[model samples]
Target: MEFNITESIQILTKTPSVISNLLKDLPETWIKTNEGVDTWSPYDVVGHLIHGEKTDWIPRALIILGENEDKAFVPFDRFAQLKNSSSRTLKQLLAEFEELRTENIQKLQALSIDEQTLERKGIHPEFGEVTLKQLLATWVVHDLGHINQITRVMAKNYKIEVGPWTKYLAILRDKK
Candidate 1:
């Protein structure tokens, strides 16, 4: 299907609530457990999403709409959540994420993005020039991917316990 700003907005707005419903008030073991080394827990995923809200999406959208065609986006810090959110409780992170997402969604709507605007270009640090559509689409997919990551990480907690069913659960299947 074609990239529709209205359709994208639908998923974008729901991400916070979807995450909150799946994660809030869970035990620390469920919140903090990772799939393996270097993987993110549900808590860490929320922080990473928060970091994106502050620095990635709208910031890059502005760059795309800005007059400076040469202005490349700042590279995102993929692991900033480890230290940035370590001291905060999962509850705090969840609440903050909700607020940030709501604000960003409002900002996105305020842009009044049209087909012409979606075609606007911005420089990406690694990928060179990219369109607003690609960025917005990525924003939607990024949320979905992370949500999948959160679920997979949660599912991995039961990998061994699932026993016979593990063979049918792709998320828990050994990738190696």
Candidate 2:
């Protein structure tokens, strides 16, 4: 489907509530399990999302919109949440994510970005040049990818219990 800013915002706005509903008040077994080493649990993913809210999305958007001649964005630390989130509860991270997402959506609306603005370019450290539209789309997809990751981690919690039925469940069978 084509990228619609309004449509994108719909998914973006719903992510916090979706995550909260899925994991809130659940037992530690569900909230804290990971696929394996180097994989993030639901709580960890929430912290990562919070980190992105604070440092990635809006900051990069502003760099794209700034008056500076050089449009290069600062490199993003993909794992900053590992350290930062160690001290915070999942509830705190969820609340902060919701607040930041709401504020950001409002700010995006206030910017009054149009077709021309979406086409504006910025420099990515690894990807070279990219457009505002691509960046915004990435923000939406990034949230979704983490959500999927969280669910996959949770499903794997039942990997052994499911036994033969695991063959029917792609989420459990797909070891990646």
Candidate 3:
């Protein structure tokens, strides 16, 4: 989906509730882990998710707002340090996620329609010329991808034993 500021804010706000509903009673420990695909347990997923919330979307929003995106922006690999900096509890990460999402929505909503379309440039060492709009779309897609990954990990962790209905049910979890 194209990432208009309004639609993206909706996606960001809705995700936490969706996660909460799906993971009902599944303890924060289970929701956050270090034992799933790519060695990124549930906890790592939260860490990554929060990191994306803080560093990715919000910074882009700032850039779009004509503020300095540089101070908050970091190189890709350096961002991983956030998880290590704290004991990195799941609750803490979740809290950060909520705060970041709210901030992003507020900042984005404050912007004029023209501001949303304004180009804020970033030079990634790998992908050159990253723009504010592209980052916003990436943020939405990134969250969706992780939600998919989280559910998949949960299914495996709990051994839900999916059947044909599993595929159909999965669709209910995501719009696409």
Candidate 4:
């Protein structure tokens, strides 16, 4: 499919509501449960998304647009959410994420991104040079990836209970 910025923003805008619809009011046990060691819970996933909204996406875009290609993006702290979210409740995190995402999308629209700007390059700490289009596309996919991750982690809570039906469940079988 062609990358439509409007469509991408629409998808991005819906993520918080989608997550809230799926997870809100669930028992703490479900929210906190992980498939196993080294995995994140649904709450943790929300926190991570919050961290990305605050640190990763727009900041990197600004770096690219500011013509700072010589300056590589700071390596994202994948686990920063653990420390940052310790005090916040799930509701608080969700609200914060929604608000930040709204603000970031507004900022993105204000940039007046076009074909030329989308082709602008930025230096990634590890990936070397990358286009603005690639970076923006990654932002969308990152959200989808975590959404899938959260769903799989939540579903695995019923992995053994599903018993014979496990054969039909790809989420339980996939070891990410």
Candidate 5:
């Protein structure tokens, strides 16, 4: 599929609502449950997404546009949400994610990026040079990845109970 900026933005903008619709009002036990010792819970996933909204996506885009490969983007702290989300409730995190995402999308739109700008290059600390288009595409996929992760983790709570039906459910069968 073509990477239409408008469609990408639509997917990016809808993430918070999708997350809230799936997670809001759930029991704390359910929201905080993990598939295993090291995996993230639904709450943790939301916090991690909040961290990305605050630190990763737009900041990296700005670096790409402003530096134009002159400066390498900083390595992201993938676990920032662990410390940063300690004090906030799931509701607070959701609200913050929505607000930050909206603000970032507005900033992105304000950049007035065109085809040439989308082709602009930035240095990634780990991946070396990458295009603005690649970065934006990653941002969209990143959100979807987390949404799928949250769903899988939640579903696994029923893995044992589902028993015979696990054969039909890829989420239950695919345990990492």
Candidate 6:
């Protein structure tokens, strides 16, 4: 698949703003509901994404740019990072997350065309020898996936379920 950097960057640019706005309207307490649930609260979710961009995402991007195909992918401890992300306010965490995302896009923009196209080689613990473009694509997909997760969590927390027909409509939408 052709990687449209412009489109990807646009998506990357909007996500944090969108997420930030979502949080801004929410009550601060809502960001940390159901603490012991298997799923993360909204705060934890954003924190995880922040940790991901700083540690996993940026490092992988650098490794790809550096053309270190033989290197192993680094593992990140997201939960631990989230726990230690400070006892700051939810708004502060949201802002920190957006700042990190902005940094990621800046780094992405600085990549030369050649660097972006370079054949990345990394040994994933499960899937080996992945390409740079593939990793970039995965990063975009990861953003959307988490947003979807957040939507689901929001719906669940509100005890609002789409009807059977709505679920069918979603499946049909995916077909397109």
Question: Which candidate gets the maximum TM-score versus the true structure?
Answer: 2
- lDDT by residue (1-176, candidate 6, tens digit) is 68876787898888898778777768756666632546677777787888888788668767756754457777767586457664867787778888888988898888864543757566666787787777777788888887766655555444435545555544323310
- Clashes (backbone N, CA, C under 3 Å), per candidate, total 0, 0, 7, 0, 0, 1
TM match of model 4 to true structure: 0.96
What is the Cα root-mean-square deviation between model 6 and the actual structure?
4.3
Q: Where in model 6 is the C-alpha error above 4 Å? A: 34-36, 67-70, 114-118, 160-176
Best candidate, lDDT: 1
Ten residues in a row with the worst lDDT in model 3?
167-176
Alpha carbon deviation, residue 3, candidate 5 (Å): 1.3
TM-score of each: 0.96, 0.97, 0.71, 0.96, 0.96, 0.80
- lDDT scores for all predictions? 0.92, 0.89, 0.63, 0.91, 0.89, 0.71
**Model 6 residue 44 lDDT?**
74
Q: What C-alpha RMSD separates each model from the true structure?
A: 1.2, 0.9, 4.8, 1.1, 1.3, 4.3
Candidate 6 global TM-score: 0.80
lDDT of 5 by residue, 1-176 (tens): 96789999999999999999999999998899987777899999999998888788889889888845365787888888889998889999999999999999999999888999999888888889988999999999999999999999889888899889888999887765
Regions more than 4 Å wrong, model 3: 32-37, 64-73, 78-82, 85-88, 158-176
Off by over 4 Å in 4: 67-69
After the best TM-score superposition of candidate 5, give how far the Cα of residue 70 lies from its true spot, in angstroms: 3.2
What RMSD value applies to candidate 4? 1.1
lDDT by residue for model 2 (1-176), tens: 97889999999999999999988888989988887888789988898888888888889999999999899998988888899988877788888989999998888878888899999999999999999999999999999998899889988988999999987999997765
Residue 102 C-alpha lDDT in model 2: 94
